[model samples]
Target: MVMRVVVIRVKILETNQQVELDVKSTTVRELLLRLGLTLSEHIVFKNGEVITEDDIVEDNSEVVVFTVKSGG
Candidate 1:
């Protein structure tokens, strides 16, 4: 048996760049790790909805990763 990879569109707020990639059906945490980004340094949103590390990511989902900022 073979498995189909899930595809998602990712957007980076810092660079204002977008990319479509094939990913495994997994949690947001794994996805961020695969993207080479630290979950603590970026805020992730799925299809306009804020998502947590444990959130499940599906195919054709839109994800936006924004760099967390510090304000004083």
Candidate 2:
């Protein structure tokens, strides 16, 4: 028997780029680290809902990353 790994699609709104991660599952923090993004610098959204770094993101799911910006 063989197991199949589904890819997770991550779309970065700031960079306008999309990347695929091959894994069974991953945490938002891990995903950010893999993409070289900082938790404080970026915000993650899964299925249009904001997710925390501790949140678990499964494979084959679409995620969006937005750069955090502030002006004062």
Candidate 3:
């Protein structure tokens, strides 16, 4: 079977630029690695809800990846 992929452009706060990524995996973790990103303690949200690396991303899903920071 041929799987469909969706490429979504996400804006990263640190870079202030849009990164177009093609997701064609069964899990979000695969997509991140394919985009050359690592899943650390930082949080990742899909439409505002926190999602884990094991989360399955459906077609046309909009994902936002952000690194968590702590400061006083």
Clashing pairs in 1: none
**Alpha-carbon runs more than 4 Å astray in model 2:** 1-5
Candidate 1 local accuracy as lDDT? Answer: 0.83
- Candidates in order have lDDT scores of 0.83, 0.92, 0.66
Quote each prediction's TM-score.
0.79, 0.88, 0.64
How far residue 47's Cα lies from its native spot in candidate 2, in Å, is: 0.8
Instruction: Rank the candidate models, highest lDDT first.
Output: 2, 1, 3
What are the per-residue Cα lDDT tens digits for candidate 1 across 1-72?
A: 876656888898887988777875668888889878898898899768799999888887888998897754
Give the alpha carbon lDDT tens digit for every residue of 1-72 in model 2.
876668999999988999999877999999999999999989899989999999999979999999987743
> Which residues of candidate 1, in runs, are more than 4 Å off?
1-6
For model 3, residues 1-72, the per-residue Cα lDDT tens digits are: 965456654545544556666654447677667666677734567888988999887656676777666553
In terms of lDDT, the poorest run of 10 residues in model 1 is 19-28
Q: Name model 3 segments beyond 4 Å from true.
A: 1-9, 69-72
**How many pairs of residues collide in each model?**
0, 0, 0
Please give the range of 10 consecutive residues that has the lowest summed lDDT in model 2: 63-72
